[model samples]
Target: MFAQVRHQLCPDLAIDLGTHQTRVAVGGRGLILDEPSVVAVDSESRRILGGGAAVGRVAKQMIGRTPDGITAAYPIRGSVVHDFDLCEAMLGSFLRKTGRSKLGLKPRVLMTVPGAISPVERRAVTNAAERAGAGDVFLIEQSRAAAVGAGLPISEPIANWICQIGAGTTDIAVLSLGDIVVRRARRVAGEAFDEAIAAYLRREYSLKVGSRTAERIKHEIGSADPLDEELVVEVSGIDTAGAVPRKAVITSEDVREAIAPVLQIMTEELRATVESCDPELAADLADVGLVLSGGGAQLRRLPEYFERQLGVPVRLVDDPARVVIRGTALCVDHFRQWRPYFESAA
Candidate 1:
């Protein structure tokens, strides 16, 4: 008990390493670092550039705007780290910025992951956290972390189904007895949504837009169903016909059309996972319904879309984008009690 208390008192950290973004939280301090998973590097100097003074929002602006010598790369993709070196550099910067409340005391770490992440990837993620300054590293599958964050009674034996649509991937899980009963992971998420929107413009409007622009359009007018008002947002892109920059207006209907296929795919994936669940667990889900959380949950009519497709009510938790981080902090706050359930880096 004394050792457990000592370990629990350490200034711990919780990191949600998504392909599109990385969120770092100090157990007691809330979120201190939230930024795109991108890192800008100067190839010749072999040094990470623009991360010290410009993390989160600032570094994000450097995307598609870097000079000849510099390159912006995402260390993570589809909720897994793809570039170990860049990932380490990125994690180091975040840890430095997300300072510990206690000086010189190393923090025990809890890094989040997708439930289906392979053993090889798990070891790599754990190693990276240790190298990046965590005293001890533990992995929490994203769906479980998310379920906790969404306020599901996962500790109870009844079923709780959740779908987390993040920037890089969509994770669906059915929980009971504090363990996942059914799990499904899909890489079709926000980034894919942006690509779909961009492709739609290219074909219909004869315009070329960057991923960022498409994302803006999605947020401003994106929807999976009809809106109270048919809104329009002005978009700037290179006109395919003129090969010059031009401004065009996109409507909610256009946005819906662009996103339909992928939305259908997401819905189908969740439904399929639910269908394949064990008979006893499947019966539980019918009464409990499913909860949708994450950045993609912010999309208009997304819940309704899921509800319609599955015939099971879909509810969105508050501030879905922060659910993973919040749940991570919750885990840290209760680490001593949960430690045995989590495997450490060692």
Candidate 2:
């Protein structure tokens, strides 16, 4: 049949165009691509370096270490397309890497976006994907994708609370009956935590480090709550006072202190979201509890921190980082059933 031949030529793709990372999944296949959302370009020409091959993991490594003529940049910021041309280029490269381009047919793509992006931002995502070799484009909110990815009973009458904390944004939502009831999206998340750590080092230790190094320190020792055995990591950075390389031993306690303000803001936001819910839904939430996903969900003791702050049961989903893409992929596999929830970007 023509449909079968078309399917063989080009299948559907589910893409999570995250601020920190980009993930892709095929309709009949699981995740096939996971890479940092980074691209290296010529400083003057603004052309993608290495004939467009300097992207993803390769470009991520060039950050904070690029030569004078080369720059590493993230085309997506806060889960929105910040640089249209670069985003198109980066996505095109990723699509080609998937080998779908070789079939000479554009694939239909389902992409996840933050719940709070403006109409213009929404269009930009579709435009970028279209220009990047997609035949048709569909958009879905990240929070909904996270809910589905976490295997929550979103179609039930009871409330399902999902908080997806990624690198640049946090999407908090309450869902029931396959739709969002109330949601909050904020630009504060993993990147803020990294910035806080970097600033703390600069202010408290007179050590200046790059974002990547700070992120490393965070992953190694960061915690929201006290650990049974606190961790310590040696960090290398430039001494602001002497302008020379130096090393400092930072503890989990220090990281917690540095990121406390950011965490406080997130906690307040979550509380506000809960308060915004109707009394009936709020009651349902109290019983069902919160489901946490995304990379930030892996923060040390984060579930315990939220439990103490929100006074509710908190559950972190398995493979938290891939939840959105996985859920989006699930939708792709069952497009007919999930079609009503998607906004057509074609």
Candidate 3:
């Protein structure tokens, strides 16, 4: 009777606590919050600014342009909590903004993290959520969650392959019987691409660009393979040789060349993951192919690039950015039924 009463008072929440963004959803509802995982704090007081409104999108825009006493930054990196208090504050602020209760009672929260995160890292995530007014923190491996979000039949006997590329890491896995058969994760992902682009411009064009500029270049023209009609974008950066600000015209070929190394690394890792699958599952993959999820999967021609390299048809999932959050919501909606998949939050 007490449990029933508590359930009525608090709704469960599922969150994708990502390196660059945080996505949240109510237990039975779909996604409700999607924001950059950023926070702005007063430098001297070390307190959250704007009465908790200086978070998410607002804080993200303040990056690289904060005032003297304000600092805007991400509290989480690579799906791991770096600053516990700030993470809590950021989560709490987002929860409040998304209409989670401000009352004494706390809600059960389920969150997703990379498959290879350490036990201590997992504990940190739970602790941050608890501090942010969550009860009964639950953890789910990102690859599994992506599989569920991609609508793969993980409970069936056939193998379901998923490649989830996020800002900080890429998780590739094969699932069968609702469990991972083979998996590989690497810290090299979207951020790495951004850095590579920045480095390439500095090296080849003598232009120094900020992180955001590099990212824009990537989104505008970055590609794995050549396109029939090439693309180009104007980029603003500091003139490395002259110490002056300038703009340069960057072509799709330039972006492709810049990111080729990291894309090659991703391809090799994905190939190794697929090769390591069991014989039966390997055969199943021939029919099931591969499903790509996450923000990185939105890159144009990504599916074709993977299909050519992996020798298997690769289909990008719809709404790739919200796949994990949707899957996390499923876990929250059917918590009791999916409890076995939750990592022991001991």
lDDT of 1 by residue, 229-278 (tens): 88999999999998999999999999999999999888888888778888
Q: Judged by TM-score relative to the true structure, which candidate is superior, 2 or 3?
A: 2
How far residue 324's Cα lies from its native spot in candidate 1, in Å, is 0.7
Model 1 residue 71 CA deviation in Å: 3.5
What is each predicted model's overall lDDT from 0 to 1?
Answer: 0.83, 0.93, 0.87
Off by over 4 Å in 3: 43-46, 62-69, 100-103
Clashing pairs in 1: none
What are the RMSDs of all candidates, in order?
2.5, 1.6, 1.7
Give the higher-TM-score candidate: 1 or 2: 2
lDDT of 3 by residue, 1-346 (tens): 9766776667888999998899999876778889999888888887778887789988866655767778776798776898898999999888776575645778888889897788898888899888888878889989999998888889998999999999998999999988898999998888989999999999999999988899988898988889999999999999999999999999999998888899999999988986898778788887889999999878778899989988898999999989999888988888898889898557
TM-score of 3: 0.95
lDDT score for residue 35 of model 3: 93
Candidate 2 or 3, higher lDDT? Answer: 2
Give the lDDT of residue 289 in candidate 2: 94
Ranking by lDDT: 2, 3, 1
lDDT of 3 at 28: 69
